[model samples]
Target: MASALDNPLLFLLVLLFPLSAMAQTNGTISLGSSLSTSDNSSWVSPSGYFAFGFKPVADKNLFLLAIWFDKVPEKTIVWSAHRGNLVLYGSKVELTSSGQLVLSNNQGQEIWTAQVTTGSATSAAVLDTGNLVLLNSNSGITWQSFDHSTDTILPSQILDMGTTLSSRETETNYSSGKFELRFQTDGNLVLYTTNLLTNYLYNAYWSSGTAGTNSQMIFNQSGYIYLRQTNGSVHNLTLGNIVSTRDCYHRATLDFDGVFRQYIYPRNWAGESWSIVWSVPSDICTAIAESIGSGACGFNSYCILDYTQRPRCYCPPNYSYLDSSNTFKGCKPDFVPQSCEPGGSGEEPRPQFQMTELPNTNWPMSDSEGYNSKNEDECRGRCLGDCLCALAIFTGVNCYTKKLPLSNGTIGTGTTKALIKVPQGNSTSQFPFQREMCFSFLEQEGI
Candidate 1:
């Protein structure tokens, strides 16, 4: 009041106040503050339950700016800013004086940013409810993490129209995957799978089947998700009887394997395990056969229910996995390819390919020429005659001659059989032996 610059002590106090206030602590990051990645620096919530910082991805030096359960043993990440884009070590996330929050790599390249118009006095805080917000006097909240979610939705978070939750590329990779759960403009909550190479097209696999204006999806504190319409009607999105319990955290996620599931985590539990309470499309193989790019497994592989009742990928007879480390890459022929020309020494003609019977198996979509036949024998004969037919599916006089790289194959309680053509010289005994070896290798690797 009396010319503060005249006094040295008062001037010093004035200069240090803003710097002291900018110090990050108690989950708050004042303007011009930064958190380093190499140092493992983070902003922890008041209760120390959640932390926002850089997380290592699968033993690689690259890291992702993510929010995770701090107390859990698994360090389960619920949200990520740049999921598909990883930053190198020694990166830093800083809130500039201009109110812009930026994530920069070690080479000083900006990886991501929140270009908000908060005043210079803006400050960021990580709330106990797992929301990261930036606030200032000019605007209450200029930015928030909940407004741009990655894959998981927490309780009290509203998924408004045009919002989506994208699944991660894999259990180990933090990049975007093929599945997405979106709140459509028509007021329907839909789950879809996208071709990674072409993001423009999507195939819906599940939907809420409701339409109304001003619709919103919310995850309640009682471990239930519901879609509330403008007419005040609530449609339950979660399945099964789930009850609320104290000290428990619930999250709904679009899983990497193209499934939407709700899970619960008990804070006081000894093992710190998460239990799946509900899931959509209860059967993974129930996707529509005619839908484009609808299958869970890749081409040349079949989806089957494993011992644990989870969908697993398997290669057919005389075929081996293209990439042994990753089953999603699909399979390839292990034996010699059958030539179109008939080969024999005498007048007696030799069969070039042998039919291997795979009962209860069928491909999702028929990518072949359809033929009307009297029985399975005729269907097999038709496929054997056509050089382009790699396999044939026979179902009650309906024959589908599939071309190479058969996709979306599934095994269930259906009356269909897939007649796969293998090289005639290859012995059938090698099929079981190769399958057993593959299973044993996977088991030993603990996959």
Candidate 2:
């Protein structure tokens, strides 16, 4: 009944009440406050869908400042800072008054920082869209976690030129891994691996094959990942049936296995796991040679698709695992290397290196020489004559002579034959099919 124009005080109180409520719901972390991994301090978004805090690296004492879906069963991390540089258990991520977001280890050593120098009043907030932003006094975002992604690209995030998504070292290790999904300056979306230290060497395994002056990749709200050019043309990168549903959260990630895949999280379900919507380099074996220095299985070994559709490494006959604990370290010769010169005493005649033919086997890299019309016999003879040639790969009339440390070897359902040189011995005559079965059995038993 107090609808009179004189009720100005009541109207002002009603307007300010919503503003105060909105501020409370936004969940801002004021300057001088810090988030600690030991205390499990975090900033949760208004809807409680996303949270930003320090997550422990598996069972290790190290931690990483990360953002993840709060309600997910696994707490799937979408972005991280200082992933490569881990901090101690008591590490703190502080938003300083100077507008810098700094991560300091237990001893007060700086692990990483956003380096924002906006000397104004700033606050950090986790938005419902999953972006953790540092906002200036004018509500302008000075820095955001979406701009510096670790391995995932959430919906509405733009991956501009020069931005890259690097996979974690392993499923449990948050350190930088070997795989990279980068938006190159040449406008091509390339996937490659970097060499260790010093002068960096890149081995590109996959590319978008497009060239433009300026290009940007984005994960739109419609669940489609696309590359947009400066001229307004768009190209879809993910061609899967990802329906844009309200309860689904979509992300494109560079998986640790050197594969770029799009996954969908059904938040509405009680215990639903992330589902793969699409993947690049559908065949893992094809991308093995795209790594730096070695293949998917390292050196002196071959890769094959196991019954579970995963890549498994195996050594040919007469070779043993270099590191039995880790097969990716490749294999080593179980017998002594055959010397070209004659041996003394009753050492008998110098053992010759014999070829063990493996059908459906292929090695992509390290082709010293090849012939278009050569037969398998000629290819074998060429390798035997050349001291540097360690293996010969032949498919139809095409021959590829590989040197030692044969990389990217795979045994698929093709007609290719990989002739591996092994020490000539009575016990080495049988093919190593039993060894393959053993490896498969071990993998199945989670050994």
Candidate 3:
């Protein structure tokens, strides 16, 4: 009932409360439901591009650490934690004994971590630019996940491809997957496959120039990364432009959910208006070039740009057709899976084939099981013998195989050699997607 300043003891306690809370935090900025705060139980970022607290999407146990534009009503989440995994009530975000910012729940078990470090003294601060920094008394960043990204690349943030693996395996989930983005010596942004240990992902250029230009722009405030040939060039490479083809203009996130996107603001009250510039399913049939997904061509096929909107799926060169339908039925070579059976006949022949682009594809189930091969030939031999192996791909002198022909939905063009298993009746020449096959009808209708 007494005024804080009038009560010196209470005033000092009030002042000390924030300091104590900060000390316990070890200087890591967090966003989420402030219902867990000891004070007013409200979470707010300094600049407001982000907020802390509970969201209503998931079940009750779900606690999310998310980021979105402060001004926009849609408040699109750029990053999310505990997506499917949620925490129970009574669990609070706290600085743990190990110096990591942990989200602990009622049972006193940790659900998540900021993973910050404290050498001398710890302090967490949310910078005006939206960067949540956990600083040592000396102002050094002991640990930061900014160096590690999920999918959304923010402005002023340097995307050191050298530090991160290539592309997301899926769109929404955050787990390590196949492709990755890299900074090339040529200064172009390239998407490469980590499995191949070479450049399998394609490139999006920022400017026509050399690499290491300080002129490139990554504005965290704007949530876009850009490139300029010179200082403040009129036209620059923007994240929106490079990735808009997928209809993922603003609602873009790079996690395991297959590089999620949205052309229009789905969260907007007026309804999202979007166009697909690049998308796996959207570009599957029509996508050309090596960096698209495997389905760009039919399974066990080469995507030939020679075909119109329907990408031409061709047999790998030298590989005889398994299906006599030849109208582009999935390409199969003379060698059957058993021909190269490890104990049977190890003599597999290699030949030269011409392909302007490789399909973006996923790893075979076998490879995901932790199968290690000495070389491509060994992998090929293994695939041939497995009988379960449906397709084989050799890249960067390494080989990978799957149990089924690449499908229109799952295949991409980002590999060197992809051998798909084709059914005798199916033709690679047939349009992979039903939509593509019916494009003629749409055109007839003035679509």
Instruction: Compute each candidate's TM-score over C-alphas.
Output: 0.85, 0.80, 0.47
Alpha-carbon local distance difference test for all models: 0.77, 0.76, 0.44
RMSD for each model, in Å, please?
5.7, 7.4, 12.6
- Compose the digit string of candidate 1's lDDT tens values, residues 158-248: 8898898898887767788888888998998888877788796466778888866448888876778998889888888786677573568
Q: Of the candidates shown, which would achieve the greatest TM-score relative to the real structure?
A: 1
Q: Rank order by lDDT, top first?
A: 1, 2, 3
Clash count, candidate 3: 70
- Model 3 accuracy (lDDT, Cα): 0.44
Q: What lDDT is reached at residue 166 by model 3? A: 36
Off by over 4 Å in 1: 1-24, 117-121, 307-309, 341-351, 371-376, 427-447
Model 1 / residue 137 / CA error / Å? 3.4
How many clashing pairs does model 1 include?
0
Could you give the candidate ranking by TM-score, starting with the highest?
Answer: 1, 2, 3
Steric overlap count per candidate: 0, 0, 70
